[model samples]
Every structure is written in C-alpha cells, then in structure tokens.
Target: MEKIAPVRLSVLGHPQRLAVFRLLMRRFPDRIPATELAQALNVKPNTLSNYVSALMQVGLLTQERIGTSLRYGIDMQSARETFDYLLLDCCRGRPELCAPTSNFDLNNKASKKYNVLFLCTGNSARSIFAEAILRQEAGDRFNAYSAGTTPRAGLNPFALEVLQQKGHDISVLRAKNVSEFQAESAPQFDFVFTVCNQAANEDCPAWAGQPVSAHWGMPDPVKAEGTDAQKSLAFQQTYGALRNRIRVFASLPLGSLDRISLQSTLDDIGQLENGVSA
Candidate 1:
C-alpha cells in the first residue's frame, strides 16, 4: 500500500482544508455540491477548488458526477484509517485508554426522541417526502410531521406514488394546514423545518416549545412543467434530496450539541443543494 498517512495528514493540515473535510464528514454518505461548500465556508471559488483538489488527491475526499454537478463527500474508510493512525500505540497497551469506535452508533435506542415538523406552502410534495423519509429512517429518534400554510384538498398523487414505490407507508399521510399544529393540544415540535421558499419567507404562527427552525427550500415538483415521466423524475429527485438531508439530520448528536451549535448545523444542512432542481 502507498504511504498515504503523510499525504492524508498534509491534506488535513490546512485550516480551510480541514474545515472542508469536517463539513463533508458531517454529511458523510451524502455528497455536497461545490457551491454549497463554498457558501458554507464563505471562501472564494478558487480557494475552495484548491482545497477540494488537495483532499481528493490524497484520498481524503471523493467526488461523484450527478448530472452536470460534481458532488463531494468524505472517504469514510480513509478517515477512519487516519484516526486509527493518530491513535496507534498511544494507549500504552491499554485499550480502555483509547476511545472505542465499535460502540458508537448514531441510531442508538437510548438517544432522546425529537419531534420534528416540516412545513411548506402546500402539504403536497417536498414536505410530505421529508416527513416520510425522516420517519422511515429515524422514527425511533424523531416524530416526523408535515403541515402547510395552505394545504391542498388532498396529498399530491405524484408524492403518494413516489413514497409508495419506495416502500414507505402513505396510508397515514394527509394534507393538513399549519394552523392545526398551532392549536393548544397539538404536539410541541422540537424542530420546525420549512421545505419551500414560500413558506420559509412567510409569517408563521408561533409553534409550541419554541422549536428551532430552518429553511430547506426546494423547487416544487408540482410546479414542474414536463411530461409525466419528467415530473416523476422531479419527484424522485426531491425524494432523494430529502432522504439524504434527513439521514444527516438523524445522525446528529442532538443531546450533545447546544442550541446555538444545533441551530447552526441545521441551517447548514438547509443550505445543501441536493435535490433543488425540478
């Protein structure tokens, strides 16, 4: 094997590169586009390009071509190897002195269950997809719900079709107004996420528990002007985006992060451009 330890360490030595690597690691399995990364880091394009190229060249980052965009993610195995190298022989033959990676699980049952609410202009496509995906992925750790400023008469047919086709239960899904959740007896949300630009920018009723909020704006698949197949593709893309975002959200150490840090992290996730196209 090549002696990549030095190369990996060198790649991570720069502050900007390290920050980029850490950000990618936060999204782990999800690939983040260059534009999102640039925005998150608040760095110029050339600077980010250099940092990204260095990380990829050293196997610390991996990039995949999705349509016309290049999405980047951390090389998890390589990252683990780097950690292993850093900790090697540091415990004086005492395993307890070193942190055990085997016991770490993001989906541990002992973690606190958070109630999450997703909102949009209409309880039709994006919000519904987010609710279903979050419930399916981390239902044990999160109570996922969806509402809209103005709900449609019924759930979007395309949304239902996509959820069902992906093996998600849609029987319990319904299009409901945001006012329903604002009632006195409604569940107090721990986090409220707006999934559409319209809902994000509009005035919303005060949620119980004073939930932390973020805007994950996505293009409305319902507004997609194309053939049935193209519209289906749009819905599928939205599903992928929401699923990826939820996965990252579910993996967060909610109990460990304080309100400010958690809020910042949530906002960063919202900035991701995973499935914005439609």
Candidate 2:
C-alpha cells in the first residue's frame, strides 16, 4: 500500500511565502536575487526582507548569497511535493484518485512499452511537432505516433526545419491521415493526445481500444503569416510545449503504475494546456 501524500504542502499559510514561491519558480533554479523577488512581488525592499526571512525558514525557499545580494527561488522538490499533496486529496475514499504503481511482474521477458498517438486537423504543423518531440523524449519508454484527422499529403517543411534546428533528426519523417491507423488491424494505443484545438474540441471516433485519451490544446502555429523568423518562432513554441508534456508523461512509472491511478493522472493531464498548465 502506498502512503498518503503529506498535508504540509500548502504555502498559503503565508501569502508572502506563496508569493516568494511563485517568484522563485518563475526566475531561479535558473538564480534571481532578493531584490528581483521583491520587485516581482512589488513589495518594498525592507518588507521583502522580513518575508524572505520567514520563507527561508521553511524548506520551500532556498537562498544563496551573491557578492552583494541574496537570491531565492521556490524549492522545486517542495513544489513537486505540493503537487503530490493536491493529488492525494483527489484520492480520498478512492485510491484511484491518485494513481499508484502497478504490481505486475515481467522480470525475465521484455515488456511492451506504451503506445501514444497525437492527433491534429492538418498534420502539417502541430501533429508533426508533437510526434517528433514525443519520439525523441519518450520513444524508449513509449511508442509515439501522430496523424491528421484530415491528412495533408506531406510533412510541414518548416516543422522539419525547426526540429532539426532544435537538434532532432527528421530525415525519415512523413505525414499521413488518422484513417491510415484506424484500419481493422491497428496497433492498440495506450494513450492519445490531440494537439489541434479544433480536433480536440470535435467528437473524435470512439477509440475501440479504449486507451487513455486526453487533449493538450495548442493554437495552430502554421496559422502565423509573416516572415520566416516569425513562423519559426511559432514552431519553436509549439515544439517546446509538446516536449514539456512528453517529459512529464515519460516520467510516470508505467512499469508499476496501477490502471486506476494511471487513469486518474491521465485525466489530470487533460487539465494541462500547452505544456505547463498542469
């Protein structure tokens, strides 16, 4: 049996500390100083000093002395802890609320990894982006595929370009429609994500396999009409968002994750918008 997530996760006990946490998570782990945190909070330096003192006292804040100032950030491990706590409440009286690891044994034989499918309206932009990132980040753990509800016969040239620019190889990529994978002998999907806002909103075919399905809504980057740089930037944002979500899904303990717990977490993944929303 899994232990319940800790209840001390809320920083709301001190609004200032909560403010400090938001400031730190936004700036540092990547180091903003005390003044930066105060400026972000729009509080006076002296007032912030007191708040910082209290926050640092708790494990939520970490501080480092620079030559002339102190930098603080929301301790990420603590933030992850708070997320776990939020999940626990969802599990009350129903352990399925907070998905736990499965107990299946596959010690000798090679176990099958999960299958993920990403869907889009056109397959030219967003689907391509999601497919590449998921493959790069989670391919070893999950087999990732992308298809368009209405196919676009070829890959998005810019999608290919931006992916390569970001260090992903796309020499063998191509575009296809959702129908291609819907045939009688289709591979069973363990999960599916729709990236296009329109397709995500539409009633998708009832995936007969009934794997976990969710939407990670994102605006169409291919809609951007302007210079190459502007279009490239749009693709970059799309790529980053997909990459972040794929990292989270891949991080889940699928090998031991229980179905109830997995389904609940997958549902929570629906609350995610773009990448960081969850």
lDDT (CA) for every model shown? 0.81, 0.69
lDDT of 2 at 133: 83
Query: lDDT tens digits, residues 1-278, model 2?
Result: 02323323333467776666654543323356667556656789999888767666556667788898887756667666666556655555455656544433322224467777889888887878877887788777777788888878787788888888878778756788788778888876777777754565344566754666666667788888899999988888888877877788789877577666776676566456667773
Model 1 TM-score relative to the real fold: 0.60
Error of 2 at 245 (Å): 0.7
**lDDT value, candidate 2, whole model:** 0.69
TM-scores of the models, in the order given: 0.60, 0.57
Alpha carbon deviation, residue 69, candidate 2 (Å): 46
User: Model 1 residue 263 lDDT?
Assistant: 77
Runs of candidate 2 exceeding 4 Å displacement: 1-111
lDDT of 1 by residue, 1-278 (tens): 13788788887889989888877754544577888788778899788999999998988888988898878987888887877776664454565678543432223424467778999988988999999999999998789999999899999899999999999999989998998888889876788888875575454555654677777778899998789999999999999998888888888988788777887788788777883322
Give the candidate number with the greatest TM-score. 1
